[model samples]
Target chain A: MIPAPVIAAFHPPRRTLLGPGPSDVSPQVLAAQSKPIIGHLDPLFVGMMDEVKALLQYAFQTRNEMTLAISAPGSAGMEACFVNLVEPGEKVIVCRNGVFGDRMRQNVERCGGIAVTVDHAWGEPVDPAAVAAALAAHPDARFLAFVHAETSTGALSDAKALCALAKQHQCLSIVDAVTSLGGVELRVDEWGIDAIYSGSQKCLSCVPGLAPVSFSAAAVAKIKQRKTPVQSWFLDQSLVMSYWSGGAKRAYHHTAPVNALYALHEALRMLANEGLEQAWARHKAMHLLLRNGLDALGVQFVVAEPYRLPQLNTVYIPPGIDDVAVRSRLLQQYNLEIGAGLGDFAGKAWRIGLMGYGARQENIALCLHALQQELSVVI
Target chain B: MIPAPVIAAFHPPRRTLLGPGPSDVSPQVLAAQSKPIIGHLDPLFVGMMDEVKALLQYAFQTRNEMTLAISAPGSAGMEACFVNLVEPGEKVIVCRNGVFGDRMRQNVERCGGIAVTVDHAWGEPVDPAAVAAALAAHPDARFLAFVHAETSTGALSDAKALCALAKQHQCLSIVDAVTSLGGVELRVDEWGIDAIYSGSQKCLSCVPGLAPVSFSAAAVAKIKQRKTPVQSWFLDQSLVMSYWSGGAKRAYHHTAPVNALYALHEALRMLANEGLEQAWARHKAMHLLLRNGLDALGVQFVVAEPYRLPQLNTVYIPPGIDDVAVRSRLLQQYNLEIGAGLGDFAGKAWRIGLMGYGARQENIALCLHALQQELSVVI
Candidate 1:
C-alpha cells in the first residue's frame, strides 16, 4: 500500500505568463470558471454553449454551422480534424515548417494516412510555392495540412494563399490556428478554409484545455462519405456533432469540461466585445512595442518581421547568457514566465508571447525590465 | 457570413447538480480553479504536478507508476487504456451491463481489437460467474473489460471477484470506475486491476472533463510490447509518460489545461484529507439516508439492494407521471438538476445522484423536498 504523501494544498503563484501559449488569462475569465458549478446538459448551460458557438464563429469569421469547442486541448483538436477528414490509405500533403507541422504528420500517420511532407526551415512560414509543388507531386492527396501560426517558432504563414492552393488542387485544407485565431487576421469562410482548429489558451486568453474548431460544409460532406469510421471515437466529429449541436435536446457524447467551457465562453465574450480586428490590431501594436524595447537590448528576432506572428515573439538568447539561468532569475526575482524554445531551437532561443490579455504596455515594460537586469549580469 | 450574435454575458445559476455525474463541485475547488493561471512547464507548477500524482496514487490506493490524469474526459481515458494495450486484431472480452460497457466495446473495436461481449441486464451487476464462463469459453482472450459501477443503472459490480477471474484466465482486467472511485470501496493494487479509469466530476466532486487513470506494471509491460503506435498521438501514453513522469525535467506533451489541473490537484488533496475509506463510508451512510426518504415518497430502486451504487441512486419514475415534466419542474422551479434515464431506461426512470459534496444532508433534504412537491402535483 502506498501511503498518502503529507503534502500541503497547492497555491500556485500568479506569475506573469508570457510564454509561447497560455499567455495571460484575465480575472474575468478566471472568475467565470469559478462560478457555481452547473450541469453540462443543463438547458441554461446549453444556451450558454449556443452563445459560445456564435461567439466562436465571430472570432473565426465563419458561417460554418459545424463549429464548436473540442473538449480537450488544441492537440486533440488537430487530431479531430485529421482523423475525420483523412481516412486510411489516403495521402495527405503535410507542410512542416516547425514543431506543430511535424505533429500534424504524426497525426496523419497515426490515422493510417500517408503523409507526403514538404519541409521548410524552422522560424520560417510555410511557402505556398513549396506546397503547390507537393500537391503537383502527389496528385492523389486528399488533404493539405499546415499550421497558420507556428507557436514553436513565432512564424505566421499565409493561410489565405495556402487554402487557395488546396482549393486549386481539389484538396480539403486542414489548418492549425492554435496560436492564430483571435490574435491574427483569420477569415475561415472568406478564405474557404475547409477545417481549422485553435486553442483557448493562446490568443483567447482563457484558461487552457478547450480547443475551438470549425468545419466547412465540404469538409462535413467528406466526413459523411468516410469509408471507415473515424479511428478515435472521442475525436470523431460526426458523433460529437450531435452533442455540441442539436440545440437544447443534445445527446450525451462525453461529459464536457463544464467549468472550463465557462471560462472559454467568457474569454470569447471578451474577444467579441473587443472587435476581432481590434484584438488583432492590439496584438500587432503590442508586438511592435515589445520589439522596440528588445532592439535596445540587442535581442534579435528568430522570424523575420514580414513573417513573424504578433502574438508569439521568438528571439535568440544572447551568446554570453545562460538560457535557463536568465529565465530562472526572471521567474524567481520578478514572478515572470517566458517560454524556452522547443524542438530544434531548444536551449538556443526564448519565445516571448504577447497574446490576448497579455498584450499590454505594462507587461511589455515589466518583461523588458526583467530581461535587461538579468542579461546585464552576464553581458 | 455569420454575423456575430450579440449575447449578454452568461451568469450560470448556482445549481445543485444531483445528476448521474458532474455532482456539485465544492466552493473550495471552484475557488481553486479561479486562481491565477500558471505555466504548464513552470518549476512550481511541475512541483504541484508531483503532488497531484502522489494524491492520485493515494486515491487509487496503488503504487502504479503509470498513474496520471488524461487531459480530456473519461471517454478519452477509456480510449487511452484500450489504444495503448489492445493492439490490432486482438480479442478482448467486453462485458455489457450498461451504457459505459457498450462504450468500452466501441473503444475496443476502434482500437482494431475484436470484442467478445458478455451481456447482462442494465440494472444488474456483472456476474463473476458469468464473466468466468466467458473467460473459459474464450481462452485466447487477452483482456477482460467491464464497468466497476454502471453509472446508467446505478449497479455496482464485483470488481475484485471479476479481476480474479481475469487473472485465473491469464487475461488483463480493464475496469471503468467512472462513478465508483471515491464513492465506493476500490483498492486497485489489492484487487489486481490491470487498468482502470475514472471521472473527476463524480465522486471526486471536481468539475467535469479530466479523467484520472492508472495502469499496473503488468499493463505497462503489455503497452511497451505493443506492435503498432497508439492510434492517437494525444492519447498515446508512451509519449505522455515523458511529460507526466520524469520528475522536474518533464517533456512538453500538450499545452496542459493548467487551471483545470489546479482544480484537480485541490480535489485530490481534499480526498486525501478526508481519507479514502472515510469518503466511502460517508457515501454509504448518505445513500441509506436518501433511500429511507425515497422509500417514504414511494420511489422504487432499479438495482437490487446488494448491487446498488451508493453514489448513484437510480429509481423508476412513478407510473402516470410525465418524466420530462417532473425533471423540468425540479430544475426550473427549485434550481435542482437530476439526471434523466439514458439509453434503454430513457423516459422510464430518474437517476438521483448523491455524489461527492452533493451526498450531504442539506442536498439530500433539498432534493427530497423538491421531488415531493413535483410528484404531488402529478399523483
Candidate 2:
C-alpha cells in the first residue's frame, strides 16, 4: 500500500490575474460555484442550464439553437468544431497568424483534413485579401478556419470580412472566438460564422473549464449528414445536442460539469447585466489606460493599434530586461500575475490581459505600477 | 444584436445528492473551490498543482509521474486513455458488463481500434474466466479494458484478478475506476494496472468536471512510441504530460480549470487525512446500514452481495411501482435526488449512491425514509 503523504490544506495565494486567459473572476461567480452541489440532471440545475444557454446566445450575438458550453477548455472547443464539421480528406483553408491559428491547422490535420494555408505575420490580423485569394485558389476547400482573436499575439482579425470571403467561396467558416467573445464585437449571425467557440475564462471571467460553442444550421446539417461518424464521441455535436437541446428528458452524454456551469451562468448573467457593448467599451478603455501607463514606462506594444486586442495586450519586453525574472518579481512581490508570451513571442514579449473582471481601472493601474517597479530593477 | 434575456441569479436548491455519481460534496471542498481565482501557470498555483499530484498519488495508490487530472469529465478521461494508447486497427479486449463498459467499447472504436468483446450480465461482475478465454483467443490484443466498478449496475469486478490476467497475457490493463477509486480497495502498483482513469465526482466527492488519470511506465512507453498521433488533440496525453510533469517551467497545453482543481486537491487531501483503508471501510459500513434500512423497506438488490459495490447500490423497482412518479416525489418533496436506472435497467432499477461525503448514517437514514414515504403513496 502506498502511504499517504502528510500534506497541509492548500490555501492558494491570491493574485490579481491579468493573464492571456483565466482572467480575474468576480466574487459572485466564485460564490455561485460554491453553492450546494446538485445532481447534473436535477430540475433546478436544468433550469439554470437553460438560462446559461440563453445568456451564452446573447454573448455570442446568435439566436442559434445549437449554442451550449463544451465540457472542456477552448482548445477542445476548437477541436470539436473541426472533428465534427471537417470529415476525413476534406480540404479546409486555415489562416495562420499566431499560435492559435497554428493550433487550428494542427486540428485540421489531426482530423484527417488537408489544411490549405494562408500565412500572415505574428502580431498582425488575418488579412481578408489573403484569405480571399486562398479560398479562390482552393475552390475545393469545404471549410475556412481562423482565430478571431489570437491569444498568443493579442491580434484581432476582421472575422466579418473573413466569413464573407468564406461565403463567397461557398465554404463554411469555423471561427475561434476564445479570446474575443465578450471583450469584442462578435456577431455570429451577422458575420455568417458557421461554427464558433469561445472560452469561459477569457472574456466571460468564469472559471477555466467550459467552452461555449455555437453551430449555424448549416454546420449542424453538415454534422448530421457526415458519411463517417465523428471521430471523437465525447465531442460529437450530434449526440451532445440530444442532451443540450431537447426538453426535460435530456439524453445522458456525459455528466455535465455541475458547478462549473453554475459559475458560467453567473458569469454570463453578470455579462448580460453589463451590456455586451458596455463590456467591450470597458475593455477598450482599460486597454488604453494600460497602454498610456506602459508607454510612459517605455514599453512598446507588439501589434498595431487597429488589429490589437483590447483584452489581451501583448507588449515587447525592453532591451536588457529578463522576462522570467520580471514576471517572477511581479508575481511574488506585487502578488500580480501577467501572462508570458507564447509561440514566437515566448521570451520577447509579455501579454497583459484586461479581460472581464480584470478590465477595471484599478487592475490596469495596479498592473502598470507593478510592471514599472519590476522592470525598473532589470531594465 | 440579439437581445439579452433578463435572467435572475441562480439559486440552486439544497439537495441531498444520492445519485449514481456526483455524490454530495463536502462544505470544505465547496469552500475551497470558492477561493480566489489564480492563473493556471502561476508559481503558487503550480506548487499547489504539485501538491495535488502528490495527493492524487495517495488516492490512486500509485507513484506514477504521469498522473494528472483531465480538464473534462470522466468520459473524456476514458477517451484520453483509449485514444492515446490504442492506435488504429489495434485489437483491445473490452469487458462489457454495464453502461461504462459499453462506453469503453465506444472509445476503442472511436479511436480506430477493434474491440474484442467479453460480455457478462448487466448487474454481474466481469467474468475472469471469460476474460482469460478471450485473451487466449486473441493473442494479438495489446490492451485489456474493463470497468472495476460499474456505476450503472452497482457491481464491483475484481480489478486485481483482472489486471493479473492481463499481465499474464502480456496486455497492458486499462481500468475504469470512476466509481471505485476511493470507495473500494484499489492498489494500482500491486494490481499491476497500466492506465487508469476516474471521475472526481463519484467517490472523491469533488465537483464534477475533472477526470484524474494515471499511466504506468509501460503505458507511457506505448504512447511515446505510437506510430500515429492521437486522434483527439485535446485528449492527447503526450502533449499534456509536458505541461503536467517535470520541473518548474512546465509547458502550456491548456488552461486548466483552476477552481475545480482547488476542489479536487481539497477532496483528495481530505481523503488522504481519512486514509484510504478507512475511507473504504466507511463506504462499506455505510452501505451495510443503507442495505439494512433498504431491506426493511422491502427493496431487493440487483447484484449479488460479493459483487455489489458499496458506493452505488442498485435495487430493483418493486412490482407495480411507478418509477417516474416515486422518484419525482422524492425529488420534489424531500429535495433528494437518486439516480434512475440506466441502459437495460432504465425504469426497472434505482441506483442509491452512498458515496464519499454522502455515505453518512444520517444520509442513509434520510434516503431510506424518503424512499419509504414516496413509495407508500405510489405503490
> Of the true interface contacts, what fraction does each candidate have?
0.87, 0.90
DockQ comparisons of all candidates to the true complex: 0.81, 0.88
User: What is the lDDT for B4 in model 2?
Assistant: 86
Cand. 1 TM to true fold: 0.99
- Model 1: colliding residue pairs: none
What is candidate 1's lDDT per residue for B92-176, written digit by digit as tens? 9999999999999999998899999999989999998888999999999999999999999999999999999999999999999
lDDT of 2 by residue, B228-274 (tens): 99988899998898888746879999999999999999999999999
* Interface RMSD, every prediction, one decimal place: 1.3, 0.8
Span of 10 residues, lowest total lDDT, candidate 2 chain A: A370-379
Shift of residue A93 alpha carbon in model 2, Å = 0.6
> Given candidate 2, what's the lDDT at residue B153?
97
Q: Candidate 1, B303: how far from true, in Å?
A: 0.6
Write one digit per residue (lDDT tens) for candidate 2, span A1-379: 8899888887877788888979999999999999998988887888888999999999999989999999999999999999999999999999999988889999999999999989998998999888888888898999999999999999999999999999988999999999999999999999999999999999999999999999999998999899998999899998898888777988889999999999999999999999999999999989889889988998999999999899999999899988898898888888888889898998999999999999998888788778777777655
How far is A367's C-alpha from truth in model 1 (Å)?
A: 1.0
